[model samples]
Target: MSRLVKCENGHFYDADKYAKCPNCSRGAGPKKDVVMEGGISTDLDDVKTVAMNIRGNIKSGRSVRIPKVSGRTIKPSNEILDREEQRMRELQEKIRDHKDSLEEQVTLAKESYEIDNDKTVAVHVFENGIEPVVGWLVCVNGEEKGRDYRLIRGRNRIGRDSGMDVTIRKDQKVTREEHCSVVYDEKSNLTFLVPGNGTLTYYKGEMLRQPQQLCSGDAVEIGETKFIFISFCEGERVWKNEEE
Candidate 1:
């Protein structure tokens, strides 16, 4: 079938050129003013010929026309919308579970350093790069001193109290009852505090927020005992001077 072309006069033509709209003829301009439907191959020769013919048609003040397609509307089905929602929900659940897994891992790692009893002694290390570690001494009656022994968390100067590094030694046993087991506060930064039947009171700097994580070589304090903080993943306790 011959390719159909629409002309400015609203006429459909198989002919390469068509008449121009009479309404646009008042200016007495050349046929170049006519607008034709696009789909034709415009080789140089064809362009010249079509242009010349259109010019002539415009001079004659005639009309050209083309066919118009009937408009149609499409709407998505309910099933499609339902499937999209389901896919989105699945993706959301996947994200949530991944986060939960990370939190669980952090909890397990913190719990690994939990001190078992009051007599069990272990240092709270904050070697991690972020967040300061503080040490609060637990009183015999089971209360963390809010004032005395409230050393700020962070790097403990080499000659602070008795003049010793705060890092924990390899082979030290951490007891849960006497000392606090390591636990991560809401911020995910590891915290070592004593937990017991005695009233747990906040000490100086206790109200401060914790950072997200710790870096090796960071220092943290637990009560009167100061500890060098290290990642639980690659640290060993060193013990030699225990009072028998």
Candidate 2:
């Protein structure tokens, strides 16, 4: 865009070429007999400016133009109006999408950390013993995704109950507690999925009737949620006391 400026005195000048309005800085002068758009003078009357250079000021090399007074408001062209409406609609849609994303993040944070007995307070880890985290149960399919429950050195009970060690609270079909068991044997350094009080725990598309050894990528299904088991205390990497 042209960086030209029009002073209140109707003088058009390149602002980049001067600090202040050059015409206004020149001080006041007697009113010119003619008012042209690109004409530079302090006494230039209240003439409306257009996009063309005045014929009389051709020698000045500026492309500023002023139109004779018509005393009418110029309405924007139809193309300009349409473009403005489209821009407003797009902006509104972007704002709506951003609001929805923020709401989802806030909801997830509350469910993961809030101290309510009904929701999850899984954010804090209180260690009464030196039990090391031996594995992880990450929910791969459910109302929530990418949420991981820690598996400690001993039995990590799985259920929807807040009191459960490996809680999957979003799935209603899960039992309140003891939906299943994910156990880490410290002596043998192996992890196993043990059937709980629930009707059945599904592992590898079959009902688990007995304790089945779990591997790093084994799928376990209890109620409506699916989890991918990952063992950290296997392959000679078992956790032990520092002094031991």
Candidate 3:
């Protein structure tokens, strides 16, 4: 078993065997005087010799030692620069091509509208004279008349009256006199639906306030009767008898 004890110098150690503290025995060594080399007399002589040598070397123009560096700055090659420029040019070309394709699509859409109305009307005028029999009206709603109305080069009246060009008896909404009239334009070669006085008439699903030119596949609603306008003079001419 170890026991703790304190020395007179205030150091703690194990005191199981020794009577006096072991830490006090470590300070019993002998002292000796140390002699240093290179006294002031010899040091001054050595410093003077080094100074004289430095002065002689400077006067002789001797080169002094300096640190050397190994790395250098690098630049891109011309071929690499040319390849990057070419890649940029190709990207620009692709952007131009994409823009051109979009413009072409817009142009085609405008052309489609022109062909749907203007060009077709022009061809009809050439084939059937300026005021052409452009289309016909077929009854979609109301009484079965067993007949369709043939549109011609002049004003065609429509009503419940017997004197009208097209008559509908079963539709109570139809007026007795002139309910509506389909008129042909000699200059434009277009057909229009003109609403009569105090009559309810619609062209292309909208109420007709004034004369509206009829296009292919347009619908005309007179009173309760609905008629779809079918154009025959748009693409190719269909031959019909003089009586029709």
Candidate with best TM-score: 2
Q: Candidate 3, residue 191: CA error in Å? A: 0.3
Off by over 4 Å in 1: 1-75, 121-239, 242-244
Candidate 2 local Cα displacement, residue 80, angstroms: 93
Mind giving the per-residue lDDT tens digits that candidate 1 earns over 28-80? Answer: 23333222344332233234444555566578675533234322335567899
Q: Please give the TM-score that candidate 3 achieves against the real structure.
A: 0.41
lDDT measured at residue 64 in model 3 versus the true structure, 0 to 100:
28
The deviation in Å at residue 74 for candidate 1 is 8.7
User: How well does candidate 1 match the true structure in TM-score terms?
Assistant: 0.26
lDDT of 3 by residue, 1-244 (tens): 3344545654334454567745457662222222224221222222333344446557867542222222233557889999999999999999999868756654443332223345545444444465445578988776743457777554667788888867777787888876877765544556677666435788888877666778777988888878888776543455333455
> What lDDT does each candidate get?
0.37, 0.66, 0.61
Q: Rank order by TM-score, top first?
A: 2, 3, 1
User: In model 2, which runs have C-alpha deviations exceeding 4 angstroms?
Assistant: 1-131
The residue ranges of model 3 lying beyond 4 angstroms of the native Cα positions read 1-133, 234-244
TM-score of each: 0.26, 0.47, 0.41
Span of 10 residues, lowest total lDDT, candidate 3:
38-47
Model 3, CA-based lDDT: 0.61
Candidate RMSDs in order: 17.2, 17.9, 26.8
